[model samples]
Structures are given as C-alpha cells and as structure tokens.
Target chain A: MREVEPKLLKPLVAGFQLEKTLTKYIVSQHNFLYCQKAADLDASVGKTTFTLLRQINELQKILNQKIMLYRDRFSEADVYAVYCEHPDYEGLNDGTFVDRIEDMCELSTKCAIKEWNKSQIRNEAKQACFLFRERRKWLEIYKTIHNETKTVWLAQRHH
Target chain B: MSMPTIPPEPHRPNRKEVIIDLLESIALEEIALSHILNAESEKIQAFVGECLNFPTKPSSKEIIKFNKGVTQLLESVVMKEWILLRKLENVLDFEDDCEPHHKKCESRCHCSPCHSCHFPVCKCRCSHKKHKDHDCYPGK
Candidate 1:
C-alpha cells in the first residue's frame, strides 16, 4: 500500500467548514420559514417536510462524521485500501454515495410536490441538491486519489 | 425669476424585483462556481492519471513533478470551494436588504401596503387588472 503523507491527505479532507456555512445561511433559513408557515400547509405536506428535514439532518451528521473520520484515520495509508476497509466509506456494500444522493433527490421532489410552497420547499431542495453534489464531487476526488495511489503502490511493489 | 428646479423622482425599486435580482445573482454565482469546480476536478483527474506513467521507481524529477501536481490540485479545488462559500454568504446577506418590511399577501398579485402612501388599502400601485376596479388607490 502506498502511504501518503498527512499533509497530502489534508486537502482531500478539507472544506468541512462549508457545511456549517450552508446550514447556517441556507438550510436553517428554510427550516425557520417552514416552521413559521407550517400551520397553513396541509397535514400531508407537514409530514413530508418533517421527514425531509429529518433526513437532511441525519445526512448532515453522517457527512460531518465521515469527513472527520477521513481526516483523522487515514493519516498515512493508501486511499483505495482505506476506502475498501473503512465502514463509513464502504457502507456495508451499499451502492456508492451516489445512491444516497438519488434517495435525497427523490425525497426532495416528494416534499416539493406536497408543499408547493416555493419559499419553504425550493430553497431547502436547492441546499440539499448542492450539498449532495458537493459530496459526490468529493467522492470523485477520493476515487481519483485512490486510482493514482494504486498505481504508485504497484510501481513501488515492482521496484 | 429663477425657475424652481424639480428633482428626479427617486427610484423606488419594487421589493419583488430587488429580491429577484439578488436571487438571480446568487444563481449565477453558483453556476460559475460549479463550472470552476468541474474544471478543477478534470484537471486533477488528468494529472493523477498521468502519474500512472511514472517509472517503477520514480526518479527525483518524477517525484518533484508528482508533488507539484498534487499541490496544484489542492490549491485549485480547495481554494475555489472556499471562495464559493464566501460568495454564497455575501449573497445571502443581501437577502435582508431586499426583504419587504411590510407583510405580503399570499397572492400572485404581489401587493403590499405602500409605505409611502400610508393607505390601508393601497396595494403598492400594482398593475394587476384585478385590482384596477378595487376601491383602493395610491394616496386615497
């Protein structure tokens, strides 16, 4: 396995601070507005929003934990090996992070349909979409790092 | 006798228009950031793929090249993401500036009491034909 230096790995795990900003400015705004006007919405819409918000909150927690884990645990290891071994990264053979993004999108659409409140639903949907897109982008980065590191490992083995 | 000078009507941007402008700006900035990120990702992906062609045991030259590629990737992608967050924050801050102080009704007419007119029924001079026959008028 190719052991990359911590400094090199640092950038890969960078930008967790972004989640805080997004939550503060975007997600929380939607939440606050929804809470204020929720009484007027249909019961079904309220339930859906509740589920959607819960899902978002859970996803945020998981994402934050995963980023921190990556920063702390993989100080000096092959990116591929780490991904393969880490429970959070591997996700118990579940489909890649892309699958979770698809799930979120489905929920977002459902919430939007039920609520029909543009101010309450659309901004939250956008924030969720952007967050998942960011996560997926980072996943690609990890995979890229993994492929290169794998190549380096093979070359080192040969050497 | 000197003619009395008339001042230009002070421009009062519609609250909805102001909000829409801010939102459009935010959307444009987001699109720009997304494009920058995609380009940076492509650059890094290509560079990493190039690393595969290095010799079994990279010489000092190859090592230096690889390190430089890694550093550049970090600088480009991470910095761009940080800048995106800052820009988004600024745009969101502008939202407060556009928010109407008066409560808006839940209709598409986009009517609100005119702050300057101080009339209970003045719907901010909305041109909605539905309101044309309404008893309310500006300064009435």
Candidate 2:
C-alpha cells in the first residue's frame, strides 16, 4: 500500500511541476514581447509596429496553450481545493482569472489602434501610434503577473 | 484698380469663407469621433451592469466571448478615429500657411459657424437669406 501510494503521487507531482514551469515561461515571454513592442514604437515606422504585433500574437498563443494544459491536468475539484487552501486563491481565480486579463484586453485594444495607425500612415495621413504602443506594454506586464499568480495557486494545492 | 463688382443680392460666397468652412468641417469630424466613442462607452457600461445582475453562474466561455466582441468594436471605431485624427493633423500643418480669404466675413456669414464647414455661406451676397434661423445656414 505504501509503494502504491508513492507511485500514484508521482504523476500528480510531475504534472504540477510542469504546470509551474510552463506558467513561468509564458509570463517571461509575455514581458519580453512587451518590451520589444515598446522599443519598436520608439523606433522609426514600419519596422517596429508589425514585428511587435506578431510577437504579441505568438505570446498569446503560448499563454493559451499553457492555460489549456492547466485545465486538462487538474479537475475543477482540485482547483477548488487550491482555492480553499490559499488565502488569496479566490482573488486570483475570480473575475476572469487575474487582473491581467483586463490588462491583456487593454493591450489588444491598443493593438487594434496601432493597426489603424498603420493604415492611416499608408494613406499618407498624419497620426500618432504612441497611445496603442503604451497600452500594449501594460498588457504584457499584466499577462506575466497573471500567469505567475495562477501557477503559485496551483503549486499550493499539493503542499 | 477697377471697381469691384457688387452682387445684386446681399449674399455671395467668398474665398476666405470657403477656407473657414473647410476648417469647420474638419473640426466637426473630430467632434463626431468623440461622440461616437462616448456613446459606445455608455453602451458597454450598460452591458456590464446587466452582466452583473445575471443570475446564472458566470461561465468563462461567455465572458471571453463577450470580451472579444467589445474589443473588436473598440478597435473598429475608436482606434480608427485616433488614426484619422493623426492624418488630419498632418493636413492641418500644411494648410495653416495660406491666409484665409473669409476672415473678415466669418461673423456675418453662416458658412463657417462651426468647424464642420469649409465654405462659409455668403450672408452679404448669397441668395439663401430668408431661410429659417438654422444652426448656421438657413435657406441653402
């Protein structure tokens, strides 16, 4: 019975660790993308805008993957246990899962604005792209912190 | 210099009036953009209120779907206007140099009453004088 218990726990522990690693990676990548976008906005036209947007999309895909994995490995009951154990767990899970989602939404908004600015520039119209770029930066930070917080919440479930 | 010909009527459109009218038109576009954004924001606030009152369990799927729609709408209108405003600013930079011909008649004419018109109606020589006292121009 003792041997069986250890074996049973192995996969669960491994899965939990994998989730933590993935969450960290996603958060880091999100931050990197944001910084890149800001640098691009500061630079000359055409080069920075599209590149930054592509990076954002890539980071978003990675985040989605991690989120899916987290969902797949753990049942709602497991998540609820973590929520019950952690003091701030409810804060992390409630209202769209982290304040970061709101930040990302804001970033997505800025991306739309940036895209519009690009079109206007193509038409030879004068326009500022700074506002959108600024919002994107905030978004990147928000996503990173959000992922980290979720990962911590999950890790607490086991200990 | 040959005497300037006087119009039989008290209303005639002048070059200065036209420039002022153009400026007004441009200004109106900016105002329109702001109004549109304001209205959309109000709608979003109302939607949020409704969502808060909903008795059903909040589904992540539903929240995500609604969020996406709102993001798209903001992008389409508010973002587009921001870009347009930038382009308009550039146009203004160049047009500022030329002296307006209608500076003197701006008060008397209704053509450039606001920033929406680039051609001020000639109250001194134009034919549309007896129109109802509209916001700017009355008859024509």
Candidate 3:
C-alpha cells in the first residue's frame, strides 16, 4: 500500500551504491579484479571495525554507569573508595585484603569473566577485520575495564 | 596491520558489482537520512547527519572530492600499468611470431641460468626477473 520502500532497505541500497562509487574512486580502475579482493576485504573490515567499536562503547557506557552508581551511593560514606572521575567508576573498600579470601576469590572470578568477554570480542574482531589502531583501541578499552573491574572486584560487597 | 581474511573466492563479491551496490546503497542512505531529518532545520540536521554515522556512512560532499582526487590518480596508475604490461606482452608475442622463435636471442640471454626467470620451466612465456607480473619481454 505504501508508495516508498522500507526505510531500512533504502539505507542498504544507498550503502551499496556508495560502496561502489567509493571503491571505484578508491581503486580508480574499472579493471580492479586483482586488488579488488583486498579492497573489498578492507571495506568489510572498516564496517566491522566500526560496529565493534560501537559495541565496545556501549559496554564502556554500562561499566561507566555501574561505577557511577557507587560513586553516588558512597560519596559521603566512611568507606575507602578509588574513584575514576572521567566517565567515573566509584570503587569502594570492604575492610582490607586481610578480609575473607573466599570473597576475594569470588570477586576475582567475576573479573576474570569480564576479561574472557574482552578476549572473545578480540578474537571475533580479528577474524572479521582487525587493524593495528583498532586493536590498540580494544586493548585500551580492555585495560580500562580490567582495571575498573578489578577495583570493583576488590571493593564490592561479597556474600 | 592485521590482515582481513580474504573472503573465500566463491563468497567474495566482484569489484564492479560491489561498487555498483555501494553507490546505490549510498544514495539510498542519503535519501533515507534526508527524509529522516526533514523535520529538523538545516543546522541541527547537519549535526544529526554526523551523529548518525558508523564506520562507513553513505557518501558525503567531502568524500566526493576525496574520491575524485584519489580515483583519478588510481585510474591513471592502473591504466599505465596495464598499458605497460600489454606492451611488454606484445613485444614477447612479436618475438614468438618470428619463424624460428628467437633461437638467436635464446643463446644470448641464457635466461635459464637466471634463478628467477620462469623461462627454464616454461619455454614459451618469459616471466623475467625484473617484472612483477608474468608479462615481460626477454630483453634482447
């Protein structure tokens, strides 16, 4: 009944058309059969990279929120907390390391799970289209998450 | 410099086809965005356009200019390489056309002695050491 195509389909078509023009523009030759393979791979990689970063950014935001919640909850409390201010993560202190190691073990395990997630993403990303800078970025994100999560692991209330 | 796995040969889209598809997709994206942003004023819409971007957003004015410059240079290089390769091929073909097929130059070059030359294995085609591709003349 509608005169126009679906909104999603339109962008897809547009992306395809744009890819063509850009490839031709990038490769310049109508006869790009040889280099075309690499070029297409590169394009696909770029797309995948963009998607990966966005997902990572989403994850970062979630972590940011978690850290922030604690920041607000314990800002005025007597607890010792390590605060990451930029997109802040509020780390709290639960007595000290002299506390139950079982609780510490449990927390460490959770942080390990997050580490596993980061590696899984890297593995998938590399298979698709990994670049040095992008890889570096993933590392940075991982490190940020790892450090914060470790802090969270140490500071979170253990059951 | 992580290598993007070349999609297996069967799955890989042809460059021409990919290019055409990309162009269409790009146009569609712009039009879609245009409609999406039609409600907003030009200034805010422009910001919206930038915000909506992913790694590969559809075509924009800047890309057009960049494409033109890069495409022109790329086109020129590809054409030049093709022409040069073709010329080299023709010269070899001309040699082959000779009644006896370069028995004279054959002794002179001793191409078989060259480690890189494929001439020893395949007598007909001369993939000389200097050239990157299979197309080359057996420098007389």
**Chain B TM-score in each of the candidates:** 0.40, 0.45, 0.28
Listed models, DockQ each: 0.01, 0.01, 0.05
- Candidate 3's interface RMSD, please? 20.2
Instruction: Report the C-alpha displacement of residue A65, candidate 1, in angstroms.
Output: 14
- Using lDDT, rank the candidates from best to worst: 1, 2, 3
* Residues B30-120, model 3: lDDT tens digits: 4443343232223222322433332244344443343344334433433433343343334333323332323434655443322443233
lDDT of 1 by residue, A13-132 (tens): 223333323232222223322332332333433444444444454444445444544444443234443343333433322433334434434444544344454345556555655666
Please give me the DockQ of candidate 1 compared with the native complex.
0.01
Mark the 10 consecutive residues where model 2 chain A has the least summed lDDT: A1-10
Q: What digit string (tens of lDDT, one per residue) describes model 2 on residues A20-43?
A: 332333233233324333433222
Worst 10 residues of 1 chain B by lDDT: B46-55
Score residue B41 of candidate 2 by CA lDDT: 45
**Which one wins on TM-score?**
1
User: Which stretches in model 2 have alpha-carbon errors above 4 Å?
Assistant: A1-159, B1-13, B50-60, B99-140
Residue B25 of model 2: what lDDT?
Answer: 52
Better of 1 and 3 by DockQ: 3
Ranking, TM-score, top scorer first: 1, 2, 3
Task: Judge candidate 2 at residue A49 and give its lDDT.
Answer: 32
